[model samples]
Target: MKRICILVIVLYVSMTLCGCFGPGISDYRYDLATGYQLICSSAHEIKVVPKSSVGIPMIPAKVVEIVFDDTFILAKQLGLKKESENSTYMIPDEKVIRYWIINAKENKIYGPFENDEFNKKQKELKISDSLKLKDVDSYKKSK
Candidate 1:
């Protein structure tokens, strides 16, 4: 019947659309000492803890999009070799002044923002800061 055919067509279209917007693959982590955290989806959707007056208060994170070249600069700043295969680096506790997001895919730098600027940018983005930093145990669990 015509109704049956229409129902089947609608079902097929719905299934197709669902597939297009399926769940994304992402990685999340936090730095042990500074409590800086990052969530990366597709190497583009990167979010970090916004600068705040309180030290290590785990809320109000900010999102920034970085490009590929920034990764190299970050490595250099962190005393990493440009061609090193290692992906993660930790900063000394005393030097943990600002957090940054390096977009490995596009090679752009996003942060090094002061607390006030970071918070301002977060407001401009209009994104809720629901993401939280993973403690040492939680970070280890992910690995």
Candidate 2:
């Protein structure tokens, strides 16, 4: 009986470490575009997947909000850069809000850029100036 118990314990630990018992996605926020989704794996982790499919390269972020037009998706996110680089954890290295852009037509994604960099890319991409990030403070208050 003791040997059987030990075996069971080992099996459970192995499964847990291998992600067989990992946290499932807690929420899914879909885009109007077919197959685009923002999945909240946890409060601190959001994943942007192409075609709503896992295993493809995705943008990892903690999203405050996302807006979409016919051509593009703009998300106001935090921890995007850190999450993308370090796949092992979902913690935010910095609490800074950054802008990420996705070109729906091309199926391409752009940076978790700072204000200056985002502005530069904004012009280069010809993203409409009217597309604005909703104020983070206001979002928090409303929530």
Candidate 3:
């Protein structure tokens, strides 16, 4: 019984130290400044939360990817609309990839838009076309 208890304790301690049961930030990347961070907390959740330097920005849905990062941040979020229970429109849920942008320079944020709307907003904001969205995994691998 003593040996069995010691073995169980050792296993639990090893797992905990290895982060198997940790619910902490798994991926964190910088955007524009030191205080600005794009974070993915917990491997199981698999979502990104942009932490702004200026103030707290609220994001409604789970962000899947951080597409662009500079003075401005563009992210792909999961789920924006849901089909009404009684309505005719059958909008798919979670299948749609919504876009969100955060202007760290100006402390302004815009979000949860379709592709066209996002483009239009980009143009309106006079953001440079040179800055492009990137594949998060590929970008990480190259570094």
Q: List clash counts for every candidate, in order.
A: 8, 0, 0
The local lDDT score (0 to 100) that residue 62 gets in candidate 3 is 52
At residue 51, candidate 1 shows an lDDT of: 31
RMSD of 2: 7.4
Clash count for candidate 2 is 0
Residues 1-143, model 1: lDDT tens digits: 99999999999999888756744434455332232344433333334442333433332222332211212112111111222347453222333345443333333445566656655654554434543323222333131
Q: Model 3: runs farther than 4 Å from truth?
A: 1-34, 44-55, 58-61, 80-93, 139-143
Alpha carbon lDDT of each predicted model: 0.38, 0.66, 0.59
- Candidate 1 has its poorest 10 consecutive residues by lDDT at 70-79
Q: Which ranges of candidate 2 are over 4 A from the true structure?
A: 1-26, 52-57, 80-89, 94-96, 135-143
Ranking by lDDT: 2, 3, 1
For candidate 2, write residues 1-143 as lDDT tens digits: 99999999999998777764555534444543445665665667665667645554456666766666787777777754434665765566565778788887777778878878878988999999887765322321110
lDDT of 3 by residue, 1-143 (tens): 99999999999999778775544434544343223454444332334443533345644445556655457777666663435767754332567778877776665679779989989998998878876665444344210
Candidate 1 RMSD to the real structure: 15.7
List all candidate RMSDs to the true structure. Answer: 15.7, 7.4, 6.3
Alpha carbon lDDT at 81, candidate 2 = 42
